[model samples]
Target: MAKLRPNLTDVDPVWNRIRKEAQDAMRNEPLIAGLVHSSLLHHATLERAMGYRISMKLASAEMSEQLLREICDEAFDSEPMLGQAVRADLAAIFERDPACHRLLQPVLYFKGFQAIESYRVGHWLWQQGRKDLAYFFQMRISEAFGVDIHPAAKIGRGIMIDHAHSIVIGETAVVGDNVSMLHSVTLGGTGKDDDDRHPKIADGVLIGAGAKVLGNIRVGHCSRVAAGSVVLSDVPPCKTVAGVPAKIVGEAGCDQPSLSMDQLLRATGE
Candidate 1:
């Protein structure tokens, strides 16, 4: 087992908590001691650890782990907000997902969190006018994680993608902060237009599993989209929408539907 470091409360409480969890994990499961130490305790900061983790996951025969690690380190170092987003994403998973018992779980195991972090790095590359490199990151992330997010897509912080299988966010899509979506959700275009042709999901929205919000539409803030719904038009704020051609069935049932992670659709009267 890796020796526990001194309390890092004064430096970074979140990173400190994750390191503590990692040490406990190593003690509980000696089989993963090397994995935990190499992945967590080996780094001095969360950014360094994330760079190592993302590179390990995305590296392939086409790209060496060392090169990918360099790219990830550059992204994390060049942009401080990336680190902030990482912390917020960790908090989101821990607070919302029942399966997430510790902060270390998302860092060491969850594909959703890993995919999102990889997307953020690709987005940074895109913004730096390195489109081809960004595309490379996108391809590797999709191939590795089964989640496809265009590097040009504008996604805000504190986002949680549960299950994260077959998720497709188009280039023009804009996702707001604190939004949560389940597996197989697609923010895609209708294939008719060439520009600005994807969905704009507002803050605090809860999109259920297999939901498809197609076209250049807006899903308003604090709304709930029921499972398997096919939304083709704009949805108003604080409303619950369901059906193949989704409609406003009722209220969102709470102020922050994403935070609650509640998918049950109560009757309008009930």
Candidate 2:
């Protein structure tokens, strides 16, 4: 069990709320009381809790839970930005996903959230030149969560990946801040290229389910990629694109399409 850090509540309202919710959860369902206690209440900070969760979810016969926990803890301790990203991601999920009712929900049950946090640890390893360990994290994350994100992929904070099944992000893919995407979305390369071959998704973009933005193209900020669209070119800011080889359909419909979680396509008159 992890020890609580002192003065955490004074500066971290998110952790405070999560702890409060964990206590409430224990009261609401006594069966999971032990789980809630170990996963949340035992920890001093959000980062420690996150490290435990990540290790628990990704641990296997090949890797011990204790070792994984140590790696995750080291990552969080070495990089303050990882903890910041965790808070941003939790907020993004709570704010964007209707199914997410509490900050604790994503931490305890959401595979998407778990997978992304695991990816963050893998990414930290990648940055530290621990490529083999990073690859191990990627493999375990994919097997455990069905979400395949290369450790080399650069994904920004405040990202919400709903469902998260069959999601693929290749090496060199750069996803900007506050981006939202549903299941089966792929940010991949067109074909045989070794350098910088994946798509670049800008900030506040909403990518609907089954959308594939391939090649080294840019999907500009605050844009919308309608479900099942196959985007092969660059998209301008605040535009909606849909179809096999997606073309501009209309405005993104809101300033922050990702946050709005809107997927409808309105006609010209409307």
Candidate 3:
């Protein structure tokens, strides 16, 4: 059994910042006060707020929001990493995305962030052998966010899925920490080789928009997959690949391609 990590005691500055922002928004826009209060101010911690937000977004006629909130709360309480990951993701978006100015945007507005958090709860349920509930989460997330991430897909911390539309991660896909990808990315299988047949993306990899990385291939650490590229083979570390069948076009250009969010090829590129 994995050890239950320590519960957060110190007041999270990120949560405080979010609350402050929410308070300001309430004053600035009187019309949205109700929405702001229910989503941000009503909850105490980031985890609780996230749970409520996700449950509210993904709830259906069949599943009540109250029940889903409990499930999400349980997941956040049991898995401290989920809370940590939320903070990391919030930070990642604020740091990497040029459009994101405040910490409140991802939590209250961004579908990508919400989808990933929902997937984390589903992933926790998957680990707990609640396959049915996990599948339900996958279904709702796909319907609500247009992102289909399998619950069994192992994604690490600090993930930023920009636009996040049409993002499909296979059941066996393993994405490492601090990875960033744009819209229409797929970490899918080559065919029906069900057993462990998905891409293993290393840390700090930047997968550009409309890129499809198929099969049980390894995208090495800090590599960049250029937009609209189809990668069928393994990518070496710190390299840039572009084309239908992606080739090492050049160096990754920066140490952290994901952090840089730089998709443009350098002048020296072949």
Rank candidates, TM-score, best first.
Answer: 2, 1, 3
How much lDDT does each candidate structure score? Answer: 0.95, 0.95, 0.94
Q: Which model is ahead, 1 or 2, in terms of TM-score?
A: 2
| Candidate 1 TM-score over all chains jointly | 0.96
Q: Specify the highest-lDDT model's number.
A: 2
Between candidates 2 and 3, the one scoring higher on lDDT is 2
Tens digit of per-residue lDDT, candidate 2, span 94-127:
9999999999999999999999999999999999
Q: Write the per-residue lDDT of candidate 1 for residues 163-182, one digit (tens) a residue.
A: 99999999999999999999
Number of the top TM-score candidate: 2
Once fitted onto the true fold, the runs of candidate 1 whose alpha carbons sit more than 4 angstroms away are 1-9
lDDT of 3 at 262: 92
lDDT of 3 by residue, 225-257 (tens): 999999999999999999999999899999999
- What's the TM-score of every candidate structure? 0.96, 0.97, 0.96
lDDT of 3: 0.94
